[model samples]
Target: MTKIEKKNLAWGYLFIAPAIIGLTLFIVAPMIFSFIISFTDWDMITSFKWIGLTNYQTIFTDDIDFWNSIKVTFIFAIVQVPCVQIFSFLLANLLNSKVKGVSIFRTLFYIPSILPFVAVAILWMFIYNPDFGLLNQFLGFFHIPPQDWLVSNKLVIPSLVIMAMWMGGGAMIISLAGLQGVPNYLYEAVEMDGGGRIHKFWYVTVPMMSPIIFFNAVMNLIGVMQAFNEAYIMTQGGPDKHTYFYLYMIYQAAFKEGHMGYASALAWILFVILVIVTLLVFRFSRNLIYYEAEVK
Candidate 1:
């Protein structure tokens, strides 16, 4: 309990005060308010009316649309997350190699990641246009008929999944950083043990990269669950609501449908799902993630 120690501790707390305040104001406070709002039937124009668990009951028991949205979101997470991760990892591996114009290639690949989701959705709409789009034009060369991508119920989810990969450069960059951190001696040792490229990758690179892969997978899972802009901007949850994502449902409830309290309930439900899913991933990943520090 030295005077100088107390003064230094106070200074440290002062330095971190802004971050604490920001977190409370922006994240913690809103979460608490949203939880309270979820319990009441409060459309923006109407006075708040306490409804208890009616919203939850309706969503679980009666709302086919809500269940469909849940199904769609689950499918999106399952398919999109793995695809994006694998693609990004491969791209990172390619970019990690020493090659001419590699920096330019890296920049080109990463450019899509920085583009706004709204702009990406709009851009893809042109590409998916059946009449005279680039995709159809390409298919014409192969003598295949042009397909209505986003307009077809069966194809819409897949189309969205494909479009989701556009921003995978962020994950690629993270994978690249992880790759760089792998010690050169490990690969050299693997090579000395009659290990070929595949062997080295599977035995050395994969285990070393597991931590990064796990990190990227968890983050992508969260983001994909909350996907909105693509479904909203591109498809508007169209083609018989096949592309309807959960966040789009929430947006419609909160803003377009004027069901703010219902939307708040949906938001809280989604938050719980996100937490559960994330925890499940972490729990299962216990045996998979490898740390160099843990080996010794």
Candidate 2:
């Protein structure tokens, strides 16, 4: 290579060195260390003890709570992903329309997404409180009975899902942007075919918006699957472990119980599950995601 070429290459590496170093230090190296730690039995307070596959064996055979966390994680993902995505998409669509005061409503809908997650969870906790809470008070005005929003097993998961909906404000903004970009001629073509609003939505809007939908769905799925803060701050694994998400269990082991090794194993297991689930979604989404470049 010429001297100039070598100089350019060196400069390029110099510019990107910080990013490479940061990734190795903060992400890649820690992942490798955690994997190694998973094979041992060491609470942070004690010396390391090699346990081989014992942690995995115990989890598979004896740890009832592990299975419960797995169940709760998947259940939360399944319920939250679609409901939040669809609701946000519809809300965004409404906001995108020529409704009066839409700009105000759009700002209101997205304001929660920027708030601190802990603060949002605390706010929802107040809303869900049975006595002197805003929710029960509003229900009382309508003569509806006060319902246990978070304390009951049946209500806890749903209450968390409702709280998660606040985080979907970002998704609503994305959907709004996608809705605005949709070509007017496409809707006109649907109208010419005597299609109603449902037909236009199903044929024109959804197809045009599929890429945005797919992106939001994957994001929501991953976020819900690895849920922690809502369960931690509000339920703390709940009245009956109904909100005992997988990540929360890992946190409980590592921090609360000081079982760092066991927690690493649990974290790796969740990592594997999330990877497989995400890959499966990508695999099956071949026909679902529509890009405008395809037409070009």
Candidate 3:
């Protein structure tokens, strides 16, 4: 390589060296270790012994709770991710419009997202309490009978979904930034073509904001799929394991039951599932995600 080109490459590597080191030490090493651990039986008390594929086989064939956890995670992902994304996008659009005290409102909405997850989960736990909780009291005014939220198997997942949506304002702020970055000239040109609000939005806003939407969708998908803290704090996977998400189950296996090998296998399975889902999203988004260069 040319001397200047080599220097430029050296500078680039220097700039990125810290990040590379951090990832290798914190992420890559742990991941490799975890994969190796998945093939052995280890309880933190005894030496790990190789067990072949028994742990994985048990998860697929014998562990009913494993399957149930998968079902719950799938349902949570299906329901919560789309709802959170749509709500966040709509809120972003509203905040993006010319409005008084928009900044104050944005800050208020985003506070929940910035708060620690444990705090948020605990706060929601109180709000969802069947007796003397705000939600129950509000419903009581309409003569609706108090219903167990976190305690009810039928309602636990949905309750958690609501909590997730409430704290989704951080994502809304990001979407608003994306919305603001969209060139106003696109809207102006569409208006010059005699386009109405719906037409302008359909042709301009959605197409331009699609990349942001795809990003948020993928993030929310990963978040919901690996949901643990909410279910752990709120219901403890209670009410018949109704809210027991995949990651929660993994925790229970590894920490609670001392089945580290089984939990590691489950973790790998989750990793594969997330990879496949992310790839599918990118594949499908190719046709939908719009680039400015493609528009003309």
Compared with the true structure, all predictions reach lDDT values of 0.90, 0.90, 0.90
Q: TM-scores of all models?
A: 0.97, 0.95, 0.94
- Runs of candidate 3 exceeding 4 Å displacement: 1-15
lDDT string, candidate 1, 224-276, tens digits: 99988878788888888877899999999999988888999999999999999
Backbone collision tally, model 2: 0
Total clashing residue pairs per candidate?
Answer: 0, 0, 0
Model 1 shows how many backbone clashes? 0
lDDT of 3 by residue, 130-226 (tens): 9878899999999999999989878887898899889998789889999999998989999899999999779988999998998899999988889
Error of 2 at 190 (Å): 2.0
Cα RMSD for candidate 2? 1.7
lDDT by residue (243-295, candidate 2, tens digit) is 89899999999999998889999999999898999999999998788888896
> Which candidate ranks first by TM-score, i.e. highest?
1
User: Which candidate, 1 or 3, would have the higher lDDT against the true structure?
Assistant: 1
Mark the regions of model 1 whose C-alpha exceeds 4 Å error after superposition: none
10 residues in a row with least lDDT, candidate 3:
287-296
Off by over 4 Å in 2: none
Q: Model 1 scores what on Cα lDDT?
A: 0.90
